[model samples]
Target chain A: MEGLSIKQRFQETLKSVYFPFVAIVVSLLFGSVVILATSSTSPLTAYGHMLKGAFGSIAAFDSTLIKAIPLIFTALSFSLARRSGIINLGAEGQFMMGALAATAVGVATPNLPAIIHLPATLLAGFLGGALFGLITGVLKVKFGASELIITIMLNYIAKELISYFVNGPLMDSASSSYPQSAPMEPSARLYKFIPGLNVHTGLLIALAFIFLYYFFLWKTTAGFDMRVVGFNPSAGAYAGMSIGRSTILALFLAGGLAGLGGCIEIIAVQGRLMMTSFAVPYGFTGIAVALLGNLNPLGVLFSGILFGGLSAGALRMEVMTRDVSSSVAVVIQALIILFIAGRQMFAFKRRYRYRPSSEKRKGKTVVDDATEDESPTVQATAGEGE
Target chain B: MNEVVSFFSTTIRLAAPTLLAALGIVFSERAGIVNIGTEGMMLVGALAGVIGSYVTGSAWLGMLIAVFVTVLFSAIFAYFTVVVKADQTVIGTGMNLLASGLTITVNRALFGASTSPPEIDSFGIVAIPGLSSIPIIGPIFFNHHIIVYLTFILVPIAQFVMFRTNIGLKVRSVGENPKACDTVGIRVGLTRFLSILYSGVLAGMAGSFISMGMVSFFTEGMIAGGGFIALAAVVFGNYTPRGVMLSSLVFGASNSLMYRLQALATNIPSQFLLMIPYVITIISLCIVSRKSNKPLGSGKPYIKE
Candidate 1:
């Protein structure tokens, strides 16, 4: 690795993460232009606020890290599934279900040791998400159904199901009126690594999984099978790999990761489940994180942190300068994604524009473009990218 | 029975949006490009329609503007996906978020509130002279608004388009196999772009119906996940115009039924009723997905060398 030239290393990084890197830069530039046109707040000040809010003080850093913890878990889950060719957009719903499952255990279970209680709660979360993911995965393999439709339908179903649970089965009788569950036992809470920071041991747990995922992908036979299946299932089948099993496992693992994120949120971040809240957005954002990270386990950490910073800063932006809507962050993120999608379009146009007419003599194959044929304004009807 | 008829009548009115949106998805998807961003497209169109109507005080002018603006936006999508060849899933998802955020941001900036759009006069109901006197179908079918009639008119037009013309054949050929179509001189990208633009126009109409017809208002997230449901209807309809209309009607009536059921007290939780459409979507998809039936090379990028 050390013998490799700098240019080679740079090229490799570009090959792996170039799409997201370009997307981020393009989005930022677009964001700066928008800010310039509208708000009195300069890009530098907005960025400064973001940096300060994310890492200015120990408390801020802790808060940022804590927020990123669940994202890390879910993003990693998405990466795992992506590697196996399953687009699991249901992580948000899975995350919520996981939280609901974990909370139920914590609230219902009797006395137990802190160690056992914490792990059990987390296990419940993982199992719930894994089960949810596997149901879709299994149905896909067994029934040849498009996972896309199933996952989307399941997402809504799960959302409503959980709403019902919280509203009826899980509602806290003692609390006033709103639909929400009781806080878990103190024993169920994750232990803190950083004293007084409220930074739970979940960070280390997330990091640990990252390392495990890295090793699993690069060093294990099962990982190879999953990757192979992802690249070409027919080839994997011809090579004696069980494509069905790999798909199921990949999705299950992804769901487990997302489930763990939900568990972390309950035990380490938010204490209990709340009905009609924002949980799925993070799941959707995890796709961005995975893209930003180029699907590398280690890269996800940085990307998650970056997105976490944006979220943290958005809150600050909202509080300090109510004049500038915090939704600017979403716009920025959307721009990054837009640019990435449009990157090849621009490149193709450049080629057509710059290349001499005589140079286009060969019968070159055109890449078939597939994208949503709607404007961003029409996007509200679609919701979170079904 | 009167209550059912009244509800059914109201439902056809409500279903106007879904039917239009489903038709839009059909055009885009039948051209072999999967359009998952119909939700975003509708929102943009709705906002465009509202803003246009508000500024000009003309519903006709508003519809025209909606089609034009939404088509332009769809053209951007077409430019990126058709010409540039980006990952459709990622691009489509990003487009959805971008559109949603941008519109809401613009709305808040313009309106000073993140609530409903300013109201406008709805399209007046049209009574088909003697048909209004028919027994069971009378009030539900004959006595309806222009938009409702328009939806019905589009179905046969859509069917004719999908099955009759050279363009439709080209579209079908491209969707099934771009390579095969390209070999025979069909320009897949251009067809897809046109189809998508067509989708944009109808989707705008669907959005406008919500703002200008159903409620005469726009709220944040007003498309309300109908875009995806429409996409689901595409597969359920098996890419045929007639099949799609039937699927749309089922979904529309289901949505209407849920609202009606909501009016009456039932033992089951209201959340369960809300979940019915989504649950049915999953069940139906599971069934559809069961046969491994889909357009060949569906949603896959077509690259020519």
Candidate 2:
């Protein structure tokens, strides 16, 4: 490890940053083509409006930040589970459960001070999402049910649960026409920092979590064990790490983080829960967010903000240009995921000038490992390389 | 007796899309790609079918266009998973999002917001001359859209092709062990690409049936979760065409039952009625998890050195 120089370390980090940047640019370029084909307005004009809409003014920046808060938490949820080698697709459901639990607690508590009530609601949100995640984790461990299918089923169930509550039992009596909950009392609501700006203290919580994510995952022993299990369960087992326990724990944390995101969206932003909520695919978007961030804590922060900016800008572009649908943001996001996932296709050449031949040899071995399963060819290749 | 006939007819009608999509998935899974993007591919097909029909004033043209466009989309999936060695599940999810976004964006652009697009001519029930007179089976199966008949016929065809052909052997071999297939001189990438394209074509046809055969107009997200249910059918069917067809019938029957229950106007909440199919899928999946046998390399991407 000590044999690496400063230049090599810089190149490695730059390589990590390069693909995501290229992916974003390529996606946006492809997006321009879509806009050109569909709408009368030029892609440049629409994109110009999007940029202006996202960050041209203080209010725009504020909206972008506000929109990014839930994404950050959801991305954190996804990245945490990915680190443990579990693809937690239930973030959408867990986030909804968190919002539901927070709304329930917030509506019930009318006398507590801000400090007490806020923490209680947050805890409720975490527990709700955690329990939801635990169901999938436990199912996978005990019954071997694929989390992918289970989580998708759970998301549908969660959506139905929310719809049932808002329409039947938890409906606001004062607003009979609308299927939504009663607004939270002032004591429970998150305070806005700037006057007249929609930005709230939830940003602070998200930032704190970003740091905690870095510290907990990189600095803690448990986090290391989870990552090891994720990388290779058999190897982790050989190293005395419990794969099942790590799986469950990582998912729990993931769900709790996403739930906290849901809680914040309700308490700090929306104030009440609607039956038809999450007009956007925030949970799915978070997958892209985690991947674009390369599953790094700080990287998630930037990618979350970038996506939030896109979301905010796309809405404005739609409003300003009547023909442009905000759903184009979805296309751009999908394109980003495609490009990032297939970054190997865009690799021009290896940058390790000092070790290009050896690196190419290593790359060949990796490809062999990927396409083959215990074949003699793999062994033959490995022997020749050695 | 009339209600039973109506129920069976509706069940077959509803099951057609899932059956078609699952049939396509069987090919891809057998060749080593899971192709979860069927939902997205179906969505694109549905919308494209409507657009094609509206433009050409021919529903058949719409179905053709749906297949063509969806094949293009599947090619993208093929490029990413088969050639680029990306994760299949993630790419599938991305495809879904892309389809959802692109369809809405294009729909809004083509036909402005809020106003309903003009309805185009679509496939209707086609009764067979002699078969329509069969006592029990006539109305239930003999009298339906041409797509429905095509779907049923495709099942047996799929079974035959998958079980008794050289290509099928190559595809299954690639999935079971790509390394061995490669050693034996099979073009693994090309086989996977063709298999994925089969899924793409069928999913598009499934989408076209929804927009043109079942409903006359395309709405945003008209495909809904039909693709996902098809995916479940693929799983429940144990990766066999006939098995997938049977599982699709079960889901189709549940859908038909839901419509019937709604017509009865019972006091029960609609949400619970909607929940029925999903609940059944979850339960079935849990039970099947104990004895499941997915393709060995179903979700893995192949990367040759």
Candidate 3:
């Protein structure tokens, strides 16, 4: 790969894209079967409704972007942590903590100027999520706790914390028994940037972060060190890189990104943090998005929008097709992840047929070419070769 | 004395589902597969149990159906992780999402988004005739749901089977070193696959215990981190059957105490009370992680070269 021409590298990347494309198509096909079995409406009709709902109008596109903004943020969070070799399953908790902190800051000081109030609220949200994510990193490094289990535990704990706050200390008194916080001050709100569209400045923020994600990972020395550690922890340690620092810093940034998403979601879209705000599962959906995008920043942007379309469209599909539940979106999302992760299921028999002949050649250049031809399959099988 | 007796009785009852699932975890983890999908499998089992009883009107048949469905569900997980050599944790997360979505979709499709949960035949308490008469021991140990007794009885059997049986040795060997097992003609993939399916069966039974044995109906997200708690118990128990039982009992005790505090109308918020088990799991994991005896091949895809 290092010796490959620029065009060859670009072609290789493009070839990898087809795997995710195939996964999406396969998942949607499975989803159609579910729709056919569960509802009276034909799968075609249901899908038609979904398409119309997602892209038939200016309003629908706006809804798609609005739904996608948070997903992109969370996808970035997952992608960053993953690139650094840590599976941060606590994005859900981090997102929640972010929203919680944003709410606290957004509502507490109502009279401040927008510049200070809004940034402070956003910063608070980021800090909240970062701190939450740091717990997993700290526990893993210090106590040898499995981040997989600990992150899951933190998710439950965070949910309870939200329930406790919304039901008691932070409950909006003027709302008369509702378990939700008061609306953010006008200064703290994120106003719409696009003319006549419901989408907020969050879209701009998402785009900026996407670029930053690309730049930081590809161009920065710190990001390179983190990636090296993620690729081979022992080797990185031998090379004098601090695995702990990379892990801790990666999680902190990852949490902060997701937290920023939560903050933006509250200020731009929901207006107030409610118990029901998390019902959509932005964090988990972001995982699907991240995987679909192959963990590329540009790929994340597109997949995020694609998932957002699914969500926005499913609501309309449910309304039009009374028997089809909107949860089909979730099924499709999960299926995509399954298909992407187990992509070997889709690998062609050509690989098997080609391998023996390649081995017969046994020339250095020929073997390298053979490996290059089967690079995707080899990478898929050996990506986690630790 | 009555409070103490009832408390002990309640602890066993509360511990039954998690205990059942943890026993299953012991088997799967011993064979080198981390059954993170246990939570998802349990959720699917709970729904299947209700559906089965709703259709058949027999609680026993419902339990059987639950196990059958979960075995099939876990088979998909096994195929992906074991056969395709995908990352076990990634596939597990997918299974969880799939289960959650599938359950809700199927439930609403069948029940029409109804507010009232569907009613079905639930397991009944069975007391041994003479054993019921004993003052403290009978009620606490003998008189309760049949699942409770079966769960407690399985602990010793699991301990014996795991430690003494040849099959158990093969499973432990596969988990610790799959490559060596493969060289010795042990069929590592098949052992891990079967171990996961066995875990699925117990997880399904545990799910049935929650929806049918403990209550008469299934609710969305009813497993409510019970699977995770069971996983925590597996770690806290040091990967041994007896240890898992003790860890599950401790969790159950904390859960029972939370309920009691809620019943007594303590100043502590009910939400915080509900958080006790999860909090305890985290704290316990921290303490137990230092001396971890986790399977060497756990969470790794065993690719045959």
Q: Which candidate should be chosen as best, given DockQ against the real structure?
A: 3
User: Where does model 2 exceed 4 Å of error?
Assistant: A1-4, A350-386
Once fitted onto the true fold, the runs of candidate 1 whose alpha carbons sit more than 4 angstroms away are: A1-7, A14-18, A33-44, A55-57, A341-386, B113-117, B124-129, B290-293
List the per-model TM-score of the A chain.
0.84, 0.90, 0.90
lDDT of 3 by residue, A148-217 (tens): 7788888888899889988888888899799999988999999997789999998998999999998988
lDDT of each: 0.74, 0.84, 0.86
How much is the lDDT of residue B228 in candidate 1?
Answer: 78
Error of 3 at A259 (Å): 1.4
lDDT of 2: 0.84
What does the TM-score come to for chain B in model 3? 0.98
Give the TM-score of chain A in candidate 1.
0.84
What would the per-residue lDDT of candidate 2 be over residues B12-114, giving only the tens digit for each residue? Answer: 9999999999999988988978777888999999999999999999999999999999999989998888877677777888898899989998888888768
Q: Which ten residues in a row have the lowest lDDT in candidate 1 chain A?
A: A362-371
- State chain A's TM-score for model 3: 0.90
Residue pairs clashing, model 3 = none
Q: Give the distance in Å from residue A324's predicted Cα in candidate 2 to where it truly belongs.
A: 1.9
